[model samples]
Target: MMNNAKHYNLSLDKRLADELKSIGFIRAEQDLSMWCGKERSYFSSMRCRGYGLHIGSLTLMAARIADRMNTTADVRERARLRMALNIVNAVVQEKCRLREQELLTA
Candidate 1:
């Protein structure tokens, strides 16, 4: 049973690493877009399709990181859930204004 569960830890670590890399890429792209004085596409079809995905992945990464750092599974799980929620909250707060503006112009 212990060995069977070992994969979970490895899986989580892999996922966290991938998520962090993705977030870094997304942030860099966003920064470039901002520097060019243009709106970065928000989960657009033409390009930057992973913009929204980054937000979610970032949240998951936060949770997984917290879980890995925590001592107890219960505490880790709770922290992970809260971290995920906070990520979504942050993404919503960050994007709400742009979305509202788009809606207003439409």
Candidate 2:
């Protein structure tokens, strides 16, 4: 069970990184922090702690990806961005549902 969870986390990280790279966040932590409006090393710290991006950061990323999609002129690139946005949106929704469930149980 622990291994499965770890694998899932790693896959999620890779997927998010790939999407971010696709949309021009290629300068590692610097660009990612800037794009997500976070302090330098924020994301790096989160990853080091085995805690993936918070919901707020994910929300910000989704919004930026949507904005990029709108301004993108190439249909293929727009479609790609749209797909990335969809993935981020789904993750956000899942996180929200989990939070709601936690609150209900509490």
Candidate 3:
């Protein structure tokens, strides 16, 4: 490959690919827990409640977001990033909701 100033370095690409792969692996595990094992929790037994979407649902949403976030250079990596971002957003939103519930109950 040509090393051009305009091109992203190979190391950066490798780093991103590895990160995306990790996210995919985790998401796949979540899918197994939720869809196959009848469990609603994942990743060291973290509950999936209040996150607005289960793993299956989030994966579907990710597929939709990936359509918009797609890039020519690395469509797959962008999709993984989109999916991970969506999961993070959901977790933050859910935490806020739980905090509000605690305040109201207190």
Q: Which prediction has more favorable lDDT, 1 or 3?
A: 3
Estimate, for each residue in 1-106, the C-alpha lDDT of model 2 and write its tens digit. Answer: 4455445554565566676677654447556666567887877787787776778887897899889999989999898778778877876776676657656766
Question: Candidate 1: where are CA atoms >4 Å away?
Answer: 1-73
lDDT tens per residue, model 3, 17-37:
344357773444444334223
Cα lDDT listed for each candidate? 0.41, 0.71, 0.43
Candidate 1, 1-106: lDDT as tens digits: 3333334333333343344345442244443233223455422321323223333443444455445546455765555445544444454344444445556766
Q: Predict model 1's lDDT versus the native.
A: 0.41
Comparison by TM-score, 2 against 3, better one: 2
- Model 1 clash pairs are none
What is the TM-score of each predicted model, taking all chains together? 0.32, 0.67, 0.35
Q: lDDT (0-100) at residue 8 of candidate 3?
A: 25
lDDT of 3 at 81: 57
Ranking by TM-score: 2, 3, 1
Clashing pairs in 3: none
Error of 3 at 20 (Å): 8.9
Order the candidates by lDDT, highest first.
Answer: 2, 3, 1
